[model samples]
Target: MLIIEGLTRRYGDRIAVDDVCLEVPRGSFVGVIGRSGAGKSTLLRMVNRLADPSAGRILWEGRDVTALQGRALRDWRARCAMVFQQFNLSGRLDVLTNVLVGRLNAVPAHRSLLRLWSAEDRAIALSALERFDIGELAAQRAEHLSGGQQQRVAIARALVQEPDIILADEPIASLDPRNTRVVMDALARINREFGITVLCNLHALDIARAYCDRLVGLSAGRLVFDGPPEALDAAAARELYGLEADEAVDHAPALPGPTPQVAPFALHA
Candidate 1:
């Protein structure tokens, strides 16, 4: 379980996250929803210590992560995996090699700097690639894959970390309808089969309501709501996002910017 208390983050005069407190239980699929600056990304980054919290305690499996450092910090971070919308893969490296990068906690950082991953690690990465439906692209450069395939590669890399919790920051920001279903279903399957906790940042209410077990709504850096998907009704979303009842009418998911595409998935319990 992940417990957060009094969490706060600030950048100069701007408060990014404000006194947030919440618990994310194991095997739960939770989605953080808000507009551009609602601090959804900041919260997930803070959870993995990629970004420091100005003040607060992040407890992972009963251990306080606020005070961890050096080997301890590394160990704690190893138990958590992060996925980004951009995939964050080495464009020049093969997909299998990119996945193996997750094992950096076990490998010497210096060796990683030299791009050396063990044969055993490569095999494990291949297995993950197969599971994510991109095993054929294992030897291909990351930049060579399509957007959907690239996200699959990213998921494979996260799986390589063997983490109990996965934090996905706008993971489906650039996928088509088919790929969105593929990726979200993969996450759901992992949660159901392996009991891994998934905390994701989603822009579409339809997507969150369709896949997530619970929804967390943030407004202006403060959490406005945290409950099951059913709790975030059309009216509640309008308040959280400053959208009119009609404006929230047809939210679509697509690459950020330009005309936002309507979400393809039908929302249901």
Candidate 2:
């Protein structure tokens, strides 16, 4: 289990994430929802130590992640992989090579810097690409692929990390509806089939409700709600978004219920 206790982050005098606490069970799919500056990204980054906490503790299993340093911290980060809003791929590199980068944690530093990957490593990278049905694009430059495909490549790269937990920070924020579905489906598949724990930060309530087993709502850097999607009624939506439920819906596009299908636009609300 992943335990967060009184987690807090502050910059100057402004608090970004305020005394937040949560428990994420093994193999569960969780969605963190909030407005753009509501500290969703800050909270997720703290999990992998991308952003350091000002106070409190983050414990995975029983070890305090906040206290780890050097090689220990490196190992912690590898075990807890992260996916970003902008697909963090090397545009000049081929898809396969980019995916192979995930193996850097396991390979010797000199070998990785030289781009010398073993045959077994190459095979593993190919398998990860195939998992996302992009094996044919292995030889193509990452920049040449479509946005959805690039995002899938990002996921494939994360898979090669062999992480126990995946923290996706607004991974679908930049995608069109169709691409969003594709990425979400891949994440769901990874969670269900591989039993990897996933904590995704999302903007759309519809997408969160459809895909996540549990929903966590944050507003102004403080958690406001935590429950199943079905429990997020109109009143809760209003509370979470700081707008009337109907107003929130009016600002957001109607999204299809959770399924392996695609639409055309993204819903920011």
For candidate 1, write residues 1-269 as lDDT tens digits: 89999999999999999999999989999999888789999999999899999999999889999889999988877778889999899999888788888878878889888878888677777877777667888889998889889888888788777788889999987888778877887677667667889999988787888888899988888999999988888778887787643443344333222222321211011
Global fold similarity of model 2 (TM-score): 0.92
Q: Kindly provide the TM-score of model 1 when superposed on the true structure, using C-alpha atoms.
A: 0.88
| Model 1 alpha-carbon drift over 4 Å, by segment | 108-116, 244-269
Q: Best candidate, TM-score-wise?
A: 2
RMSD vs true structure, all candidates: 7.3, 6.0
Query: Whose lDDT is greatest here?
Result: 2
Clashes counted in candidate 2 amount to 0
lDDT on C-alpha atoms for all candidate structures: 0.82, 0.87
For each of the candidates, give the backbone clash count: 3, 0
